[model samples]
Target: MKIATYNVNGVNARLPVLLRWLELAQPDVVCLQELKARDERFPEQAFHDLGYDAVWNGQKSWNGVAILSRVGEIHETRRGLPADPDRTQSRYIEAAVQGVLIACLYLPNGNPRPGPRFEYKLRWFERLEAHLGTLVSLDAPVVIAGDFNVMPTDIDVYVPDRWRDDALFAPEVRAAYARLLKQGWIDALRELHPGQHIYTFWKYWRRSFERDAGLRIDHLLLNPLAARRLKAAEVDRRPRGWDKTSDHAPVWIELSDKPVRARTRKDASSHR
Candidate 1:
């Protein structure tokens, strides 16, 4: 199955662009972040018309996540991070679709580091790490995809030196990302094309995309079982050049049926 993730920046603002990409990519499942809309205002009917079942967690004007699956039978597992007591932002959502556990996330940007926002970013990573630890115990094919707002390596950015002080490339942020991968989750894009300077996000200002200056902040992370089935992974950068486009483009991964074998074995062992 083909699974993809994209940070549309704002669901309302980029619906047209999103529709075009959806038609082009035609993924089996899609995870969206930065919806910037309220739950009531989400354009569910549009997705419904395309034969997709959508589960959305949205707030007003910022930080929302949603999943759309053409395969139908979407079962929402959770909405928002558990450890967060405030539950003020709609930044995380998880669902089971087509036998795969999918998570959509919009991690905090945490710009202008060495401050409260940065601290919050680190704390958020810790919470996410803890959550992922629990997910691994399920022994299912799982994928966590979103705009993580992190550059996992220097090769991920166009000019690594230019982003040294930015929150996305800071050592602390990279370490947090490393910790996530250390939990047996594979970075799908990197796995497909190692040591490649590929980017999925580019700033609108300063002709970033025109100059091929971008950062690989968006990602599709797969668990060990899921990784075993990964067939292909890529960033669809062409969509970002379209009119009224989001700063981010779609990143996707294709998985074969190998993971089902591992899942079945684990299930059998548990029953013993």
Candidate 2:
């Protein structure tokens, strides 16, 4: 099955672009972030018309998250982190779809470091890390996907030197991200394409996309059971080039019906 994550930026403004991409991608499941709308404004009927059943947690004009699936009924498991620093933000939502626990999140963009906002970001990350630790050892497949808003490594951003002072690439944030991986979740894209320069987001200014100047902040982290089923991971950059589209493109992973053999070559697997 194909599972994808996208930061829509603004659900209402990007509705056209989003619809076009969804039609073309036809993923089995999708996790969306940055809806920038209230719960009542979510366009639930639009998704319903496309055969996608969804559950969303939306904020009026800022953060939000949602899970959409056509493969199975979306059984909501959680809506926010156990210890969310700011309860007001609609940044997280989780659900079970097609037998997989999917966590969709829109981490805070703590810009302008050395400030309270940055502190909030770290606090939020701490809460998320603590909560995810509980799921790492689950027997079932678990997917943690979202716009993490951090460049975990230098390679994830276009210019390491230029972003050193940026909250998304700061040493502390990167360290926090590292600690998250130590909890036994695999960074699907990086794991599959080691050393390759892959990006999921680009700025509207400076012709970032045209210049291929981007960041890989959107991610899909998989638990052990889910990692074993990972067949492929990729970034669909087509949508980023669309008119008035979101800065982020879609990142996706293909999972098999059954776990791949222990010694099987990643590219050669044929899971049941």
Candidate 3:
């Protein structure tokens, strides 16, 4: 099965680019962020015409998330984080596609460091960490994919010094990402091509894409069960160069269809 994630920036504005990429990439499952539309305006029919079933959480003129499946029905498991009762933003959406538990998130871009937005970003990371703790224990196949909005390491950005004071490259933000990795989730892209400076996002300013000045803020992380079956991971950069495309490209991973066997009491006893 092939799963992909893209931060579309704005679904309505980038609909044409998104449609074209869907045709070219042909991913079995897709996680989309930054819909920037209200719930009623999601354009679900368009995706359905392309043979995809979608579940999305929408917010007006801002954050949103969605999951699309071509070969299987997408059963929504959760709409937002467990403690998020108010549902202030449409940043997270979870669903089961095929046999994998998929999580799609658009983490806040904490700009203007040492401020309210930055503080909120850190708090958000805390919630994500708490939520992921439960997921890791499940030991079932899971993929947490989205635009993380953090430059995980110095190598993840075009220039470490340039973004030193930026919230995305802040030390605390990188540390939070490291904590997530410690939970046994494999960074699929880094694992597939280590030591390579691969980027999934490029700003429109200063001809960032033209100069290849980009950041690897988008990510696809696989839990242990899914990691074992990871065949390949890549950033489809062609779409980033297309007309009216999102600043972020699509990142995807291919996994084997064979499901991870559930651990039985008998197997547990044998190991003792």
Candidate 4:
């Protein structure tokens, strides 16, 4: 199965670009972030017409997340982390699609570091860490995918020196991201193409996309079961170059038909 994550930036404004990319990529499942639309404003019928069933949590003009599956019914599991009931941003949404648990998230941008926004970002990451810890412990085939809004390592950014003071590349933010990986989830792109300069997001200014000056903030993280089934992962940079496209491109992973299972002695003999 092919699964993808895209931060559309503004769903409505970028609908055409998004539709064109969807046609070309044709992923079985997709996690979308930054819808920038309200629940009622979401173009459900548009996706339905594209033969995809979607479950989304949308805010008026800010954070939002959605899961779209072309194969199975998307059964929603949750909206946001239980750690913060007062958190009203529509940044998270989880669903079960094609027997896999998918968590779509749009983490806080946390710009202008050493401020309250940065603090909120850390707090949000803590909640995510707690929630992901519970999910990974279950050892289910889970994929937590979307725009994490942080450059976990210097390798993830194009010009590390320029972004030293940026929240996305800050030491504390990177530490939080490391804590998440310690929970046993595999960063799909990095795991697949280690030591390669792969990126999923580019800025609109300064000809960032033209120059391929980008960052790998958008991610598809897999739990143990899903990681075992991982066949390939990539950043679809073509869409990022399209007309009026999102600053972020799509990142995807392909998995085998079935989840990997431990081989028993009898099973091993049968294979042999």
Candidate 5:
């Protein structure tokens, strides 16, 4: 199966570009972020017409997430992160598509740090860590894919020093992400193309795309069960150059069909 993630920026504003990319890329499952629309405002019909069934958690003019499936129905598992009861931002959504547990997320961009927004961003990471702890206990094949809004390493960004103080490259943010990786989730793209400077997002200002000034903030993190089946991972940078396109491009991963056997009671008992 092929799964992809793209931060569309604004579903309505970039509808045409999104449609064209959907046709060209044709990912079997897609995780979209930054819808910037309310639930009622989501253009379900447009995606439906393209043979995709979508479930979205949205809010007006800001963060939102959605999962689109082509093979079967998308069953909503969760609407938002349960760890933060006060989190009203529509930045996350989880669903089951073709037996795979998928999480679509749009992490906060805590710019102009040392303020309330930055504090919120750190607190959000704490919530995400808590959610991940629960997810690991399930031991199910899970895929967390989205625009993380974080530059994971120097290799993930065009110039690490230039973005030192930027929200995406913050040290604390990077440490939080590292903790997530330590929990056994594999970074699919990095694993596939080790040491490659592949980027999924570029700033619109200063001809960032043209100059190849980009960052690999978007990602696909898979549990061990899913990681074992990962066949390939790539970023479709061409879409970013398209007319009225999103600042981000689609990051996709292909997985093998080898069924992941569930751990037996005996196996679980042995671990204890």
Candidate 6:
């Protein structure tokens, strides 16, 4: 099963690029962020025509999230994080697709440190930590995919010193991200290519993509149940180079149909 995440930046403006990628990638499930459109403005039909059923939480001219599934009907679980600092923003949406829980989020960028936006970002992280705490230990597999908006570690940034004062690379923000991983969620990309300088986002300025100056702010995290089935994780960078494309590329992961069973007299075998 292939699951992918992409921050389209502006769904309507990038509809063509998005549709093109969807056709090419053909992911079984997709989590999209930064729709930048209202619920009524979401081009649901565009996705349906591609054999995808989508559920989106949208807000006007700002953050929004959606989950698209082609493998099965999407059973929406929730639309927002519990106790979200600002429920007005459409940042989170969860659904069950093919027996797996998929969480799509577009975390706050929290630019301009030492300000209310930054404070709000931290508060949002607290709520996420509180809510995800209930999910990490679940017996059912869970996949959290989105633009986390934080450079988790120095390696996740193009240059640690260059972004030292940036909100995305703030020490507090990075610490919060680390805390999330401590909950037993595997960083899918890092798990598969720990030493590689992999990046999913790049600035349009200064020919960032052309120079390979980018950041790994986008991520797909898996719970232990799902981690055991992880087969591949990748970032399709071609789309990022396209004209009128989003700064972010799509990140995806392939999972085995079922978890590999443990060695035991009654269950010493792979499930798929």
Please provide, for model 2 over 1-272, each residue's C-alpha lDDT reduced to its tens digit, 9 standing for 90 to 100.
Answer: 89999999999999999888989999989999999999999999998888899999999999999999999999999999996646789999999987899999998889889899899899999999999988877768899999999898888999889999999998989999998887777899987999999999999999999999999999999887888898999999999998999999999999999987253343222121
lDDT of 6 by residue, 102-161 (tens): 999999999889899999999999998888878876767899999999988888888779
Per-prediction CA RMSD (Å): 3.2, 3.6, 3.5, 4.1, 3.2, 3.7
lDDT: worst 10-residue window of model 5: 263-272
Off by over 4 Å in 4: 259-272
TM-score on alpha carbons, each prediction: 0.94, 0.95, 0.94, 0.94, 0.94, 0.95
Tell me the tens digit of each residue's lDDT in model 4 across 1-272: 89999999999999999888888889999999999998999998988889998999999889999999999988999999887865679999999887789999999999888899898998999999989978874545889999999888888999899999999998988999998877777798988789899889998999998898999999998877787788899999998888888999999999887755443343233223
Q: By TM-score, how accurate is candidate 3?
A: 0.94
Which of candidates 1 and 6 reaches a greater TM-score?
6
Which ten residues in a row are the worst by lDDT in model 1? 261-270
Clashing pairs in 2: none
User: Residue 162, candidate 2: how far off, in angstroms?
Assistant: 0.1
Q: Which structure is stronger by lDDT: 3 or 5? A: 3
Better of 1 and 4 by lDDT: 1
User: How would you encode candidate 1's per-residue C-alpha lDDT over 178-230 as one tens digit per residue?
Assistant: 98876667798887799889999989999999998999999998877787788
Candidate 6 clash pair list:
none
Looking at model 3, residue 144 earns an lDDT score of 97
- Scored against the true structure, residue 63 in model 3 reaches a CA lDDT of 98
lDDT (CA) per prediction:
0.88, 0.90, 0.89, 0.88, 0.87, 0.90
Best by TM-score: 2
Candidate 5, 108-130: lDDT as tens digits: 89887878888888888899988
Evaluated at residue 240, the lDDT of candidate 2 is 96
| Model 2 lDDT on a 0 to 1 scale | 0.90
Give the per-residue lDDT digits (tens) of candidate 3, residues 1-272. Answer: 99999999999999999999999999999999999999999989999999999999999999999999998888899988888654888899998887799999999999989899999888888899889878864646899999999989888999889999999999999999999987767798997899899999999999999999999999998777787688889999999999889999999999987744354343343224
Clashing pairs in 4: none
